[model samples]
Target: MKDRLFEKPLEKQFEFDEEVAAVFDDMIERSVPFYRQNLDLIVTLLLRFLKPGMRVVDLGSSTGLLLIELARRCGVEVEFIGIDNAPAMVELARKKSRALEADVTFLCEDLMRYDFGGADVVVANYTLQFIRPAVRGKTVQKIYDALKEGGLFVCSEKVLMEDKWLNKQIIDIYYDYKKGQGYSETEIMRKREALENVLIPYTIEENRSMMKEAGFSAVDTLFQWGNFATMVARKRGK
Candidate 1:
């Protein structure tokens, strides 16, 4: 289904509701820059670090697309768990997983409160920005604490530039990119307004600092395009 969610007038703030979930796959692919390529980069990085029987968790795993792909390609025995607060997304993800016969568990739960146990790799693809800034630091700290020694936390986020003029230019470029993806100007504006306060983003440097403060020994960008970036943070020690 195409993403026509914003074509109609929105009565409430943007959310991962049933209506949004219905077309989330389309929405993500079109709205996000280098969506597929980012996922591929994540998989590639995970492949290098994942070991047989290790645990992998995806925070805010809407639609379970990444988990399904990982389950198919990882080949090695590993536990794949997807956590999403949206019940609609969780159901759709589970249905898709069953249809594909992929061994992945999709849980409808709050990521902040969920006990991650100890995972070899934890991924948060465009997830952290939605969290309130006040609690975002504590959330990253929790993710770090949930990782096993030498584990990794890979995250992708929509970032902002520190330079106001540069940020505006990049945003215009991004809007143009959306237009090229077949989204109408109205749709773009509507969605942007709907997500105004709901999706708060951080600067790339701010994101890196948060991870470092959370005790990640090293942090590096894996891919970047305009205002979007994927980064990896490694937990030190064997």
Candidate 2:
């Protein structure tokens, strides 16, 4: 389905409900700049890091697209689990994966409370920002705890900049990008209002600091465009 969700007057705040689940792939690709490139980088990086029999956990795994793609490209030896709090998202993800025969499990569970188990890799693409600011640190710690020694925590987020002028300029540029993606000005503003308090962001430095504080030995950014960035944080080896 095409993304006309915001074209009409929004009845409620933005959420990962059935309506969003149906066109999630279309919506995300259009909304996030360089998202496809980010996913490609993630897949490539995982291929280098993944070993047979390894377990990969995805948090906030809306629609399970990334895991499904990875499962197809990386073979069935590596286990893939995608967790989402939204039932609609999980259901659609399961349906799609089953239709494609992709070896990925879709679980409807709150990512904050879900156990990642002893996994080789954990991913949280465009996820952490939705978490409450107070609990983000604890969540990162859980991710750190779930990783085996030398394991990686791969994440992407809509970050902020400290410089007010630069930040405003980036946001303006992002709005322009959305317009280019076919979102009318009214649709953009409506969606923004819907997400006003729901989608929160942090600075790149703050994200790195939080990850390091959560016991990740090293954190490095893999990609960034406007306000969005993908980063990798490594748990220390024994």
Candidate 3:
């Protein structure tokens, strides 16, 4: 899966990819204020897996929302690196960070090939769906290899499931909820198209297994809201 996701050339240049960026930028901005209300529990759980001074990488970081939030709440001397393949998005992120003078750096690079060697904690929030399953395992292994012993990895994603009915039900609920939150039906359709166009997603079980196979000492789903999930794993120390 990882291979497939990465193999699809990021042919769309950054500036011309505003359609992609708009989908996310608006979505995150709309969702940001609600994070404390909706995701505090999960964020807390993921936080238990971290410590001060950790070298952290926000893989597939879109606008650096999670990176910014984590840094704000962590109260630690952590180095934050935000990685993404989209140059336009990365530049936007850098602009935002500069305005706030936040200590986060955005790198325009593919997560599949990015070196994670010294990272202590890696967080890939809502960005795993686009990763091809074929290279997913290798990507996970690369993440593991990038970490020092006992390092942590947290990935939040949109998952795939075997039950078609359940999938639709979940997707329906998602659309309805988003609509209620002010997204137009057309907007909702656009978002769905973006995911489909990008070839997004993995089954929950497949993700857990991928993490374990990549040499994580332990892997577990810490939280889920319909198809959205937070996966936690760790590299074991000798």
Q: Pick the candidate with the highest TM-score.
A: 1
The residue pairs found clashing in candidate 1 are none
Q: How far is candidate 1 from the true structure (C-alpha RMSD, Å)?
A: 0.7
Best-performing candidate as measured by lDDT:
1
Tens-place lDDT per residue, model 1, 59-178, is 999999999998988869999999999999999999999999999999999988889978989999989999999999999999999999899899999999999999999999999999
**What is the RMSD of candidate 2?**
0.9
Displacement of residue 106 (Cα, Å) in model 3 is 1.4
After superposing candidate 2 on the true structure, give the runs of residues whose Cα lies further than 4 Å from its correct spot.
Answer: none
Query: Between prediction 1 and prediction 3, which has the larger lDDT?
Result: 1
Worst 10 residues of 1 by lDDT: 41-50
Looking at model 3, report the run of 10 residues with the lowest lDDT sum: 1-10
lDDT of 2 by residue, 123-219 (tens): 9998998888989899998999999999999999999988999999999999999999999999999999999888999999999999999999999
Model 2 error, position 51 (Å): 0.5
Q: What lDDT tens digits, residue by residue, belong to model 3 across residues 1-238? A: 0111112334442231545564555555453334444346645654666677778898888777667766667765778899999886787778878887788889999887767679988887766666666777888888888988988888877776669999989888877877676766765565455456465688888888888888898987877778777788989987
